[model samples]
Target: QAGPGTIGRIVRVLLAEWNRFGQQVMMDGRVIQRGWRETQRGFDDRVGLFWRYGTGINLDGDDTDHPWSAAFISYTMRTAGVPDHLFPRSRRHSTYIHFAQQNALVNDPDTAFIAHRLEAYAPKVGDLVAYTRSGAANYDRYVNRARYKSHTDIVTYVHHGEIGVIGGNVADSVTLKRLKRGGAGRLIDDSHAWFAVIENRLPLR
Candidate 1:
């Protein structure tokens, strides 16, 4: 069960956080807060959504995957003493964050900060991870590697109390099958892919 009062309080806190630390815009000599916006990654064929406002944004696919987003939302609910199921699992292609109100929402740093903070409450497994680098230098290299060898995304599954993160130097990947199998097979010598046990279950927040 969710505490109706607490839920409202949490919403107010989040809204206030957005209004204060979030990005602001001046329109008609009035300062307005922006909450969040949908951002696209890949292209028409491999497009995905993330939330952004101002210069701060989190990408869904390349930023992190569905399971990760679920974990974050779950954590947030738990922190608010709400039922974990209140934050339902979403499809891989669905938006990471959704809102019933649009007028008060503006994609901005506050949304990104709060979302990124939720990872501390209810963590889960089999999440996609990404880096926040800005450049295209390695794009050609990754694409070429996938073209010449295998194409797969760098992701991992935390199964049976063990965590396995897949890493690959390939481009054009949308799944983690190859990184898992290859790492298990020892086909490659070293890997940026990482796997470890969850010693600490604390959420990022």
Candidate 2:
């Protein structure tokens, strides 16, 4: 297994490639100017386009596989070119009920299992983005669809528009539940996973 600081090395390599991409953005005059001057944005979060969602495993043995956000950063890394061997394309049985149902596996299969392996892992600015729905692997189509009802996987660019607030909705469904119930209904509280880039702010908190 890789050491604890392995992720840091991965981040360094990713940033190197991103800086090259940034030059092109600058030449194209597409880079956005943040209001704050002391922050540095992240490549995955700052990419012109991005995505957000949740996947989970069994958290409380409640049989309910809710969404969590572990894969967000990992997927971003995979898409960003950390090496396919490092982050393979494995089918998350716990996250996708559809996959599990089709395969007829136990309801609570291994908490985290990777099915398909990837030959290459390089996340570009426009790669599809997803997060661990619930930090485990349990994610339902209905919940994911509802969470991302208004967005698409093809991200164009990160803007400070309404999406900034709603973008995080995918990770925290309660945010939407509250909005729908006139702020009166009890929200299904769940952990959130956020992957965003601020021009000057760091990506990982």
Candidate 3:
């Protein structure tokens, strides 16, 4: 098991990465766009790094055909010192999402995360919030059969009536999004059809 400070380290790494992308913010249906984007000149190197280090792919960030959001999440986990055995790094978010779901289904002790239905779990800092991005995908959709278009954001802050999450490739940049919560302190569905919240089970300080 990771030491008690692992979760803290993860949060710190996430915030630092967010700062590197110029601290873009999205809140209350309004987007504050101000940051380096993957396609922007002079910033492609960073995105490229995400692909190489996160997914072992040499594709350039400006390659519009290949989205780097999942790579960004993988990069964050790798940079945070998560062991490969505990966190699966992949170019597609569905890979790791499915792994977490399997962990929960089997009660795997070696995994660092467990997938929970949105209503069954209230995400905290260091957890991941996931949503489907296309075609009939939802919480019950089986992810192992094939790739599903989806996205996930790391939970960075949880406070009264709101929670803040940071994701990459949002608006073409690493963006911090603030979302409102329902009376139960759970996320409210919006344009994104949220399905699961991958709980961070690592020891937290």
| Cα lDDT, all candidates | 0.26, 0.25, 0.83
lDDT of 3 by residue, 77-99 (tens): 88877877888898888888888
Clash pairs detected, candidate 3: none
TM-score to true structure, per model: 0.23, 0.24, 0.92
| Error at 175, model 3, angstroms | 0.4
What is the C-alpha lDDT profile of model 1 across 1-205, one tens digit per residue? 4544543443333333223323323222133433222122332112132122211234343443322322222333344454433333222111222220111134332221112111222213323322212232122222212112111121233343223332211121211222222323321212332211111111223
Better of 1 and 2 by TM-score: 2
Best by TM-score: 3
- After best superposition, candidate 2 residue 158: deviation in angstroms? 15
Q: What is the lDDT of residue 114 in candidate 2?
A: 19
What would you estimate as the lDDT of candidate 1?
0.26
Best by lDDT: 3
Local lDDT at 140 for model 3: 70
